[model samples]
Target: MLKDENFIAQNDDLDQFNRKRPQFGGRFLNDESEIFQYNAWDDVEWNDEQKFLAQEKIQKNCSKLMPEEDSELLENRAEFFWDEFYATHKDGFFKDRNWLFTEFPELKRFSCSSSEEKCQNFQILEVGCGVGNTIFPILEAN
Candidate 1:
């Protein structure tokens, strides 16, 4: 269970309801040309050297379980890249999240507490929790 801090307000102004009358009622659907733009491969910038280095790194780290020539390796590399990227920025990127409960008081209800009836027996299990992301948060809350 996640518990929010008590210092925050339950409701935020951005979440408040606005009762003002609408100025326009008719829906206007815009053409796809005006609403969206799609680019072909020609518009993309590809650095073969960078791509080669990234691919080599992935194959080296994962023991080349997937073939170096495999397209699937690209996707797998993307996943690994994001995982490592977030891991590198973990502390700096997540620092603000420490105040989430204070920013939104309503979330405080989600905070966890030891079960009074069986506090000693309480056990928590988390899946795919990397480098104490979930563990540290629970410890901080407690």
Candidate 2:
């Protein structure tokens, strides 16, 4: 993950939130239109209503994933459940997540920065990297 110290920030308005625009690469989003300016997570300014809605969603998703029978088993052994599930089902579940570059531009240092550039021996560990679908494209892109 990219560290916070690598970013440059700007806050023109005292009432508004501070923005940390990264200098590692070019513009994070490809769009030029003002309408699409607030597309990224950092660009978003969450109001109280949005925060309440997000909390509700968190409760909903957490409740859905909780196992009623083996409630005690999932206390800290959630990984065991996922391991068993993937072992049984295998790679049919996940396809490659090709949007790693778009979402996290720091990961696309070599190719996205310039066409002539190439990267090697870059260490990255993606948690919940099911069946290695996410990392394969990043490795291939390298």
Candidate 3:
């Protein structure tokens, strides 16, 4: 069996709900015609028709079931597939996620900024597979 590390943040001093929301991405797709202009949009609102279509697609896709043998085979060799993907694409597949810090500002609290302040025993353990797109940026943060 494989072991995985987890990070749980507990702060009795701070009220969870009263925390200020972080303002990050501003890219919005106002016009559906220009949807292809960018790879992704930040805040997007879908119309009733679009919402219905999305639901229909979800229902249609969910109805189809894969064979147990096929699923088992994929799960058995999941590591190999992921390894091949990273070997072929390397870290180039994803851009460094700078948005992580903006989205989760709490991560910055873990790192010690001044010499006078003693840093807590905090550890960020990223389990499963990836090209380090997420963890690398956090580690690089001051």
Q: Best candidate, lDDT-wise?
A: 3
What's the distance in Å from true for residue 100, model 3?
A: 2.5
For model 1, name the residue pairs that clash. 2-110, 2-111, 3-110, 3-111, 4-108
Model 3 error, position 115 (Å): 3.4
Give the Cα lDDT of each candidate: 0.45, 0.54, 0.62
Error of 2 at 2 (Å): 33
Clashing residue pairs in candidate 3 are none
In model 1, which runs have C-alpha deviations exceeding 4 angstroms?
Answer: 1-73, 83-90, 99-119, 128-132, 140-142
- RMSD, one per candidate, in order: 14.1, 13.0, 10.6
lDDT of 3 at 82: 85
Query: Candidate 2, after superposition: displacement of residue 114 in Å?
Result: 14
Cα lDDT for residue 133, candidate 3:
54
Better of 2 and 3 by lDDT: 3
Best by TM-score: 3
Writing each residue's lDDT as its tens digit, candidate 3 over 1-142 gives 1111122122222224214333346667788898787777677788999999999999999999999999999999999998998899887886655455556667655755445668687767776455555776555443
Q: Is candidate 1 or candidate 2 better by TM-score?
A: 2
lDDT of 1 at 96: 28
Which residue ranges in model 2 land beyond 4 Å of their true spot?
A: 1-44, 53-69, 74-84, 87-90, 105-120
Query: Model 1, 1-87: lDDT tens per residue?
Result: 222323122222312321221112222334446433322222234499989998999989888465656777777688887788888
> Which candidate order results from sorting by lDDT in descending order?
3, 2, 1
Residue 55's lDDT in candidate 3: 100
Clashes of each: 5, 0, 0
